[model samples]
Target: MTPSVKKIKLGVDVLIENDFDIIENKKILLLTNTTGRTSSGQLTVEEIQRSKKCEIIGLLTPEHGFFTTVPAGQSVNDDIIFGLKTYSLYGNSRKPDSKLLKSCDAVVVDIQDIGIRSYTYISTIFKTMQSCAENGIPVIILDRPNPLGGEIIDGNIVETGKDSFVGIAPISYIHGCTIGELAEMFNNERWLNPKNPDKSKCSLTVIKMVNWKRSMTYEETGLQWWPTSPHIPTVNAVRGAACLGIFGELGIINIGIGTTLPFQYVGAPDFKTEIINDDIKMLKLQGIHFNPTKFQPFYGMYNGKLCDGFFLTFTNDKNFAPYTSGILFFSSLIKYYPNMFDRGKLKQNSIDMFNKVTGSDAVLDALINKKSINDLRKICNKGLDNYRKLRQKYLLYD
Candidate 1:
């Protein structure tokens, strides 16, 4: 076996080393959580206090709350620490208001991202930037690695009308860029600034990471895996999320929300694994294998019900196309459960949610038109190719 390697130095690490001077004496508001740590595992907030360059007047917590304990979609409350108040960015309001930024001179964002659009952290970043722009505050992003790697850009761009908290920008579902790079894209593209272009654009600075590469996954970096959210319990879960998460939006199947596997398990009470097990096995999906199993979710969709689902295991991290696998799973469900499946049951929320998450109605259109998996993959790949070329200008790492 090869010797275990340590993780690369994070943006916070570099910030403390050299960028501290930029924020010196400024009353700072940190838009981060517990995952913001130094390369040696020290909490970023603690490290910042140690540096003593700027005053951390308060903190802003995102969807999962500061420590990442709150469940998905649940409202969070303020937590007090060291006499400073911690505001809930995920609750009451999703963006910084005058009260939240009171007495603050600048803002610093240092959160770990999984490199997907639907993940709410990036939306929080977008909203934070917008708020800062409106308030004329300079913002700095202590950029972290995009665990999925930056080289693999996939999925369709989110149409402007379909934007939501899950996706505020027009980018691929699995956007392959670091948080810093995404900030740059958001700033330069004027996705948020166009509304108030007359206002002074918020000054954006990105403290880039050291010794990280575009092709390296979190596993390759040898970092301790921390679940970005509650259901995404493992790094392996992140690998499959781009596909599994889309299925969860339909609100019919239980994507292991109440179980240990979350995103790794896909099934419904009426979904008979044996019926399509052979068909799915024949798809020969890249970098993944399937095991038919049954589970009972304690919460979320299909709560307290036995679900006949398949457990997905990724075999090749780099080759797997999650959205294609999702389309395959979706089309397979329609083929086997024509009578039982009901897109109508989802109502408007599910339809809008699906379109927003997948970035368009093309997948649904393909399903409705009875398009073959090969043809669907071809269309999706075309979009991916375009995104890869489009993202070339914003990439920061090699």
Candidate 2:
């Protein structure tokens, strides 16, 4: 007989169910997108409004905006929603200004965070916490799962000089900590410290989810895995995101940006698919399979051009190493398409973005230098192990 899955209660649900009085009478601002909902399919904003507990003075949207319809890397303009002032954190300012915080007694953050550091939701949280800390406003984080589960820590720690919007700090590429745990780490570790020592730290209150474990993925939690962004539409996409999303920076290659597969399929119009496919097959990489295919993205890189590439499918999720896999894949591309790769397209900003996403230029250099994937994996593993030690102290769940 199969064991039944345990139902998990989201932090918002728990907060609304028992400790709503904590939010009562406070002038609150919520930082979230469409994914901010309870497991019972109730919208957080609707539930809060219906409860009549806190006075939700405003809403702050991250990269995707309130409805999550905005395109990637596009700046979202501020707008009004449900008679409340809505602020776009992804626009002019990446965080709430002092003027915005003046109206609110506290801010409630309820955004879904993919486990990867390159995703911007955590950066929003980092900025929010910093601003809130400086302004003496409290932060209440309605924590959620780390979609990829917390048990597996992968990739390299970002070096200090390469910080960008995608990578706010020196965490692993896939840090494997929940948003709540991250909040705790950010706060306690002084990761969001204000420049002024005398300024009050943001009083962080993490309303943690009930019955969720560190080993459980989004599916195992029995909670809906709302696409954290436009491209990542399913759980498989999220897994693929760990690999393809990093490769997305290579201008010569297209990581299916405008196609349905998005991060699942990687290709280039000039690619020698058969040769590259055979090369990848020889590596015998575990936990993933590559299939040769052709595609034309309606938008983004190589738009409207038929491109040959491979579709990556994760056959064994647990054994997959996205960062190392990306390095290997990139190496193969470089080797086969040395003249066609046109890596010079990666200008300063693009180079920084690539380094920021992968957490170091070491991976890129290793691939370019034709180092063995084993050597590259070892280098990444050392950094990952160090990060794991740093992250272990901050984990909230088993």
Query: How would you encode candidate 1's per-residue C-alpha lDDT over 1-398 as one tens digit per residue?
Result: 12554447788888787868888888999988888887777878888887878889998889998888898789989898656688888899999997666568889998888877899999999999988888888899998888778766667777657788887888887888999998888887777768678542678999888878887767677677777788777876887787778777767677778887878888888887997888887887777777899888888888889989888887536776776777787788777766323556557787777777776777766776778887787756655666676678788888
What would the TM-scores of all predictions be? Answer: 0.92, 0.93
User: What is the Å distance of residue 326 in model 2 from its true position?
Assistant: 1.3
Model 1, total clashes: 0
* Residue pairs that clash (backbone atoms under 3 angstroms), model 1: none
Error of 1 at 301 (Å): 4.1
What's the C-alpha lDDT at position 213 in model 1? 81
Which segments of model 1 are wrong by more than 4 Å?
Answer: 1-7, 99-102, 301-306, 378-383
Clash pairs (backbone) in predicted model 2: none
Model 2 segments beyond 4 Å from truth? Answer: 1-3, 340-345
| Weakest ten-residue segment in model 1 by summed lDDT | 1-10
Residue 18 of candidate 1: its Cα lDDT?
A: 84
Give one clash count per candidate, in the order shown. Answer: 0, 0
Q: Pick the candidate with the highest lDDT.
A: 2
Q: Residue 87: error of model 2 in Å?
A: 0.7
